[model samples]
Target chain A: MRNRQQGRVIVGFLAAPVILYTVFVASPYVQAFYIALTDWRGLSAEVEVIGLANFAELSGDPVFWKALLNNLVLLVTLPVVTIGVALFLAFMLNAAGGPRSGEIRGVRGAGFYRVVYFFPYILSIAIIGVLWTNIYNPINGLLNGALRAVGLGGIQPSWLGDEKLAFWAVLAVLVWNGVGFYVVLFTAGIKAIPASMLEAAVLDGASRSQIFFRITIPLIWENIRTATVYLGIAALDAFAVVQIMTGGGPNDSTQVGSFYLYQNAFSYGRFGYASAMGVVLFVVTLALSAFTLRATRKERIEF
Target chain B: MTTATHDRVSPQAAAVGPRRSRSARAGSSGPTIVVAQAFLVLWAVVSTVPLLWAVISSFKSDPEIVADPWSLPKALRWENFARAWDAASIGTYFGNTVLVVGGGVALTLLLSAMAAYVFARFDFRLKGALYYFFVAGMTFPVFMALVPLFFVVQNLGLGNSLPGLVLVYTAYSLPFSMFFLVAFFRTLPGEIAEAATLDGCGEVAIFFKIMLPMARPGLISVGIFNFIGQWNQYLIPLVLVSDDSKFVLSQGLANLAVEQGYAGDRSGLFAGLTIAMVPILVVYALLQGRIQAGMTAGALK
Candidate 1:
């Protein structure tokens, strides 16, 4: 009788979610695989199973390759710069407050600083895109304006207007927008390290750098690793910011992969070709995630 | 490493600890600490300056902004905002966004909580498979499934409709909600529900009365996270809602910026950007700690 009641509850509770999920969420994921293999323009009644033809077209497509190459560059530089800067800032914030006391007090106004630093991360990326575009404006941008003000007028170039500088300009914004989250993340990780561990290292006459590399980083490896993966995933998709800021322009200097996928599917209605890019992206994302998880797997350090 | 040595080391730690360091610290930390603090101050400014710049720039005339970008606005051009709201129809866009995001967040919280409750407490056939199915959604980026989702929405007769967008948002939000909430429910003691069960309370009553209130924090965290994600949602509304009038705030702002961006109306453009960002900033500021705690709560766990 008890087992029967359990069964009834399970059936009643699970039915709606299962049906809603299967139909709406799970179905698309499944159908994408089929769609990628078909010549469906998203509005078509007939979808021919074109097999590997879309993949063939992707290999020859220069715009697709350029976009993928840009993604690769972001995947490398964004994580390194963001994580490196975050770790250093987190350490400074962790160490900045009070006297040389061994306690883990933060800088003067740490909580206030935390709240302020994390300010940009909470706002929409679209707003950020718009805001940065103004800051990078050729005629009236704050950056070039400041340069001219400082009597370094000759050094100022159109920051986002130049093909040489556009990619780096966009990258700077990505890093600026992302670093606050990591500062918060790494601060938490550093705080979790037992105060005793730091005391032990300090007592053992470890230099600041030694204490950081030998003790602090080894302990915070898990957070760093997780952050790397999350940042990696974020780097893979630069859709809205790029679309809003540069529109992959100045001769396609900043076109990332996911936006290209959107352009092909929607702007051009080449759904099949776009789906093929989507499949490749899925595989790349999955592989990168899996690799990071595997590579970062270390013996758990007990505090 | 032995217990005896560990006990003996405590005195050394105390003797050579912060007390000894304080004498040596003042002489040593002069330059390095100063440099570190300066870097932090610089970073703080880097993060903050643009938003403030945008807000203040919204009030300046186009010519003034171009003439001396650093100077304070000559006068507060309130009409920049009025023009943005009126001419660009940001008011209509704001209403549409509130309706869609508000509805989507509510439905996602409800459906996901129910499903997560079952997954945590009950055992049934295909239970493992089903739970994993929901968990898998968190890893899959929405862009991967966009084309099919677009097709699916149209086929379901949800084309260009807020309800349709809400349905998609709720469905996509499930994985994160299920992942976060199932763990929450598992952490909850089962004895409360069992005791309630002994009192002959119905299952529905047990969930709504006993468990729901208990899981309030989990619900809030997951709910707000869903709210933020839905509010900033751009890609889904872009493809699914073809009617410009039905666009969410993200799409609306992007459209507004693009339209006014070319006409060189700097004040109006900045004003539109400010309008789009202000509400999010306000909500985030008021609930900053809660949102941070909720968002990073998953990571910390």
Candidate 2:
């Protein structure tokens, strides 16, 4: 029989974490709602409550809108570009290795290839931001230097400085940093499919692309779905990237919601307004995650 | 067996024959395999080259780097690293990062594992709601809550301190740490606990002496994950801890880049970047497989 001591143990085990989690993580979340209504300059004292003014002002603020639009762009582009390329590379690494049960196994150096693909995932995003900053340097960077060497200097542009191209430049670095992770991820997922299934599809006269779309894609839907949600969440909060890379960029073309929220609270001392934006960011993240889970939800095909 | 004989002959064919007969390698199309190989190679190069440049550029003089960003260093300007480590105070930042990340990871794992054990094994009335409460922590952006969190941390009178950063790190890390760990605890068979309990071992003993030991792999993986995440944390420390001497590595690196403009020594900048990156890179290189397994275990689930 479950006794009083056991109940005491359960409470003790759960108490600290639950309380700490609530105090540190959950309380801030709930507190943000209340604090959003107040005009606090990051201090506890001398704060007056302002009802919906921050939200009202936020609705018309163009910088907040620009940041939201940039996040929208990342949400749309980063996932599609990253997932598409990851699927291809994963298939190329895993499926194109011919038959597992046949004479040969996976692709040659498959392990090595995976390590290479996964290398970028370990680096800090801030580090990635710094590395790309140097690479995108107009005068002495690798990109423009290589472009000039190819004798097509006319097309070379100041990557981070060009207003027309700054957003795309940031997105390019994000894609480059992100694609390798998904490639390794989908590779693991694709590798789990029984080889006989794929070999049968091949013997049945199915082409590579056909087998990919019909068989492999459906099988790895779970991974794709999870990856999509994570990527979408990441896209919604492009704080470290934008903060390090361009600091919201030339003319605010690449300011994301999280970074904007940060700048308002820390830089401009506008806690109330920032909390309003924070609320919106939270809602968008919630909606984005919900949308991904729903959009990618399908009948799970057990192997 | 024809298959066996074909296997024997295939390697020789793959090695000796040109690209025209390279299908013997994997039975895929010749040019397709070649193209795919080329594409993957290209991608790998793209991924590695930036880091490589960062490392190599660390050793070069600024003029040499500017002259040929692609070329190898002519002078082994070890001064750059020295200047960055001492002059730019990267060494101090690195030590600070070590302390905070270490504290954060240890506390996060302890709190998460304890909470996860309850969520995994217990069936209390609010268990479902409480677990979902932590799970929902995964979705909300941490910075979105920063405005209020600032007030909370400031009001607690723990501003600009390493311990405060550690507490914040542990708190924010709870959600994912708990989520990842609850799955691990669930996978562990319950019969052992039942047996231990039946033998008169108490609940705490059963968990500590029985279940916690079994959850080591999960703990290690989660530890490494939380360590990396806490180390890379920029926004939290950037906003909360403003003291220059107490800055974490990422925050310090940002200071070097954004605040001081790398003190006008480009090579020192690369040196600081290299110093910041190398330790993690080494650990990652050693435990690449394990890290990936632990980090992506959820995707598979």
| Runs with alpha carbons beyond 4 Å of true place in candidate 1 | A1-5, B1-26
Worst 10 residues of 1 chain B by lDDT: B22-31
Top TM-score model: 1
Q: Tell me, what's the RMSD of every candidate?
A: 6.0, 4.3
A114-201 per-residue lDDT for model 2 (tens digits): 7877767777887778778888988888898788788877877988888889899988888887887898789788878888888777
All models: lDDT?
0.83, 0.83
Give the CAPRI class of candidate 2. acceptable
Error of 1 at A25 (Å): 2.5
State model 2's lDDT: 0.83
Colliding residue pairs in candidate 1:
none
Q: Report the lDDT tens digits of candidate 1 across residue range B105-129.
A: 8888888788889889987789888
A102-174 in candidate 1: lDDT tens per residue? Answer: 4545666677777878877887787788788889887788888888889987887787778999999999989
Each prediction's TM-score versus the true structure: 0.94, 0.93
Q: What is the lDDT of residue B103 in candidate 2?
A: 92
